[model samples]
Target: MTNDFRILLKEDMRNDETGERWFQDIEIGSVFFFSVQASTLHDSTPPALLDDVMAYEAFQVTLQIRHGVYNFGKRGAWQHLEDKPWWPLFEAESPVLTVAANLPVATVQQVYEDLVACEKAHPEMTTKKCLRSLSVC
Candidate 1:
């Protein structure tokens, strides 16, 4: 993640510019690495420890754990509030790709291929090819 992203919560589940609650300015195909922070919502009525709470689900959210390049377009078209309730950058898909949390691979490539394709549908991606290098060590 390049730390160049923001999380916006939309009001209506459906796509309606006037009805949406929040909107994030992001490139259409750009991919982002994001994770919902575990949260605890507590209630105090009988002086109990707590009641209400929110937590991160196991595998409920998929993280590609890769870097993405920038493109042009609305972030709303690529992301939905239903899939990622806590924040933006959450997509319904499998995050393009994913790897083990233990950093199984030292480097990853084509993190931006999807975004690039979405930006401009061309055969160059498959023919010429674009690659990205990541450092795990």
Candidate 2:
């Protein structure tokens, strides 16, 4: 078996029917694990000392996703992102989100799918540049 693979999306969310937390990793296939804290973006992080954000939905991501990510890690204030093609690992549902970031899982899934489509179509631009250049939409 190969030692490396790409992760398209992952979710450690609560099971609606059983009220139990579940773990899901989506790559070419799915892997499962158990999590006690389902809705949390970071189980280990203390609540962020944001100026105004009361709560948010967050994810663990690769550093290449955003320009400031590596510098942010250098500050040694939080955990560093993963090192791989997953380089830009975390993405906000949007630039700014509010209230549990309470989007449906299907919607969140679609956002990642759209990101892949964007990457495929642009080939040379980062996701940010693609969306920014397409500013008409």
Candidate 3:
């Protein structure tokens, strides 16, 4: 038995002006989200936390995404908040792909492959605009 998880594409949106794309995936009743945006001059957040962050000039895959939640007593039954347990599978510059924690290496590779395929199928939606720099490592 394996605890590996997979993400199914639920929605995809892009901002033509900024070249920023958002992806939402369904997994275990929650949405796994990520984005790819064009690089910019005043990027406050370093793409990768490292001594030489510039080396990762190709792109940046930030593990930062809002976690979906269901609040039974709230007016809105569901909300996406910044507090989520999904951790980065690897550093910013790593060519190796990863998702949430505790997943096997093979599972991470599979997820990366799936994402690449999706990007290839939707070339226009992948990176057409260039507003700000963001990436999927």
**Per-prediction TM-score, please?**
0.20, 0.28, 0.25
Off by over 4 Å in 3: 1-99, 131-137
List the RMSD of every prediction in angstroms: 15.1, 15.8, 15.2
Q: Give the per-residue Cα lDDT of candidate 1 at 135.
A: 32
**Taking the tens digit of each residue's C-alpha lDDT, what string does model 1 give over 4-99?**
121221112222333212122223332334321111211111212111211112112233323333222333223322242233433345434322
Clashes of each: 1, 8, 6
User: Per-residue lDDT of 4-100 in model 3, one digit per residue for the tens?
Assistant: 2222322255544553444354322122233322123212233222233223233223332222222222311112221222233434332222223
Best by lDDT: 3
lDDT on C-alpha atoms for all candidate structures: 0.26, 0.29, 0.30
The number of residue pairs in model 2 that clash at the backbone is 8
Best by TM-score: 2
lDDT (Cα, 0-100) at 128 in candidate 3? 23
Per-residue accuracy of model 2 over 7-26 as CA lDDT, tens digit each: 32233454444433333533
